[model samples]
Target: MENQQQTWIDLAIAAMDKAYVPYSNFPVGACLVSKSGKVYQGLNIENASFGLTNCAERTAFFKAISEGEQEFQYLVIAGHTPDPISPCGACRQVMVEFCEPTMPVLLVGDEGALKETTVGELLPYSFNGKDL
Candidate 1:
């Protein structure tokens, strides 16, 4: 599990380097591996209208879903921040929609800081579209 998560961490950081962040200059990247062995990666995309921006976590998840991946087991998020930054509230909610409740979320920051947690722990009570 450690090795797998570490691999994703490296991939996440690598993806962050490709982020399109010309506004806040804060780059984020995320990578998720489906149970079927497919890998999906994404980088933060900023827009002139900040409200139109999309998070890296959701982008990666959606990209996978678009590719027909509906089940995931691992997620990795990386950024050039001081500490490990977890996913946003919206991303957390979207994650619970497709990933298992206890799916692992690996967060990494600059200087190799790493933390592993679960989606259920991050968002104790999650809801699907119908639940809302």
Candidate 2:
């Protein structure tokens, strides 16, 4: 598991290098691992209107879903920040929609900093279809 996480982190960093950050200058990358061992990667895209921006996590999820991937095993997020950054509430909600509550989420920062958590742990009592 550690090795896999490291590999995914590396991939996420590589993807981050390709991000388009004109405003915030904070690039983020995300890697989604499918149950079938497929990896989908994405980078954050920032637009002039910050509200129109798309986060790296959502980019990866959208790509994977578009490719017909519904089930996922784990995810890795990489950024250039000092400490590893957790996904935003929107991203967390998206995870709750698609990923299992206990699915592993590895957060990696520059210089090899890393932290691990799960969707359920990140957002307890998340709102879902059952709550509606």
The C-alpha TM-scores of every prediction are: 0.93, 0.96
Model 1: residue 91 alpha-carbon error in angstroms: 0.5
Candidate with the greatest lDDT versus the true structure: 2
Query: What does candidate 1 score on TM?
Result: 0.93
RMSD of each: 1.3, 0.9
Off by over 4 Å in 2: none
Instruction: Write one digit per residue (lDDT tens) for candidate 1, span 1-132.
Output: 778767788888888888999999999999999999888998999999999999999889889999899999899999987888878899998888887778888888888788889988988867776686
Candidate 2 lDDT tens digits, 8-123: 88889999989999898899999999999999998999988889999999999999999999899999999988898788999999999998999999998888888899989989
Worst 10 residues of 1 by lDDT: 123-132
Per-candidate clashes, comma-separated:
0, 0
lDDT of 1 at 61: 88
